[model samples]
Target: MPKIVDREERRREVVEAVFRVVARGGIQQATLQNVAAEAGLAVGSVRHYFESHPELLTAAAREMVHRVEARVRAQRERLGPDDDPHDVAEEIAGQFLPLDAARADETAVWLEFAVAARTDPALGPIAVELHDGLRTVAGRLLHRLGVDDPVATEHLAAVLDGLALNAALHPDRLRPDAVRAVLRRHLAQLPGGR
Candidate 1:
């Protein structure tokens, strides 16, 4: 008899496997064969879920965005309306920073894909979508905090992006606590922050 597999769960597993593969050996190593091996499945099984390598990469990128958005939603739910501006800003923006091993892997994969997307037609649109989404989230979050200056949103996103990249590339130098402190200090300088 054949085994039964939940399609969505299997796809999630494949996406996770792709992350692991990319995290360990960069995006170029996230081939179907490698990802299949990482996921403990046959290449045919991965193809059953994705039509092609580009399709698989697209799925993984979307999955990363979905995971981060889910975390942001959870953090927003925990936020108290009366919380201090600095705390609120940090709480929301912190969703983008790589604060742990898992997040460091996520950031690393994103960086890898973003660079590859520069020349890969299949990944270019996905990269642009993710980039625009980042800006939209930052804009909304900053706007809500009464930060009318347009540069504030860009500044916040830049700070988070730089911090995440640094932490992902140099985990030993910039610890999670240090990332938070740097973020908080940056937010404090904003007009409506703190």
Candidate 2:
């Protein structure tokens, strides 16, 4: 009898390998060979899961988006009726910041994918979909905090994006505490801020 392999699990392993490559050397370095080596598998095995580099990259990007969306939803669920609106806003926004090692890896890979999407037509749609989803979440956060102005929602999204990028790229300078402070300060300026 032959052993059975979990196809989805194998695919996830390959996708995670791509993330490791992207985190270390950007999307350009995340070749099938590199990913295979990272995943401790043969290039042929990697190809068995994904036919092409674009297919692998797209799968990795989709996984990243899925993980981030799940994290955001978890943060939203943590909100309580008695929680201060300002604190709630800061907590939700902080979900995107690189506050720890795992989050830093995810953010780094996401940043790489965003840049690669600019040139890779196949990745462009996934990148745009992630962006729009994030914007909608930000809009909802603003509305929950009583910020009714459309301009304010847009500005908040930009601020969150900038903060996440800076924190991911310069974790030493923009440490977790610093990232939290920046988000808290920004939330303090909102309409219902304390």
TM-score of model 2 relative to the true fold?
A: 0.96
Error of 2 at 41 (Å): 0.8
In candidate 2, what are the lDDT values of residues 35-113, reduced to their tens digit? 9999999999999999999999999999988988888888878888788777777877777778888889988998998
Q: Write the per-residue lDDT of candidate 1 for residues 121-173, one digit (tens) a residue.
A: 99898788878777787887777767866687788788888998899889899
The lDDT of each candidate is: 0.87, 0.87
Collision pairs in model 1: none
TM-score of each: 0.95, 0.96
lDDT of 1: 0.87
Error of 1 at 193 (Å): 3.7
Candidate 2 total steric clashes = 0
Each candidate's root-mean-square deviation in Å? 1.3, 1.2
Stretches off by above 4 angstroms in model 2 are none
lDDT accuracy of residue 159 in candidate 1? 85
Score candidate 1 by TM-score against the native.
Answer: 0.95
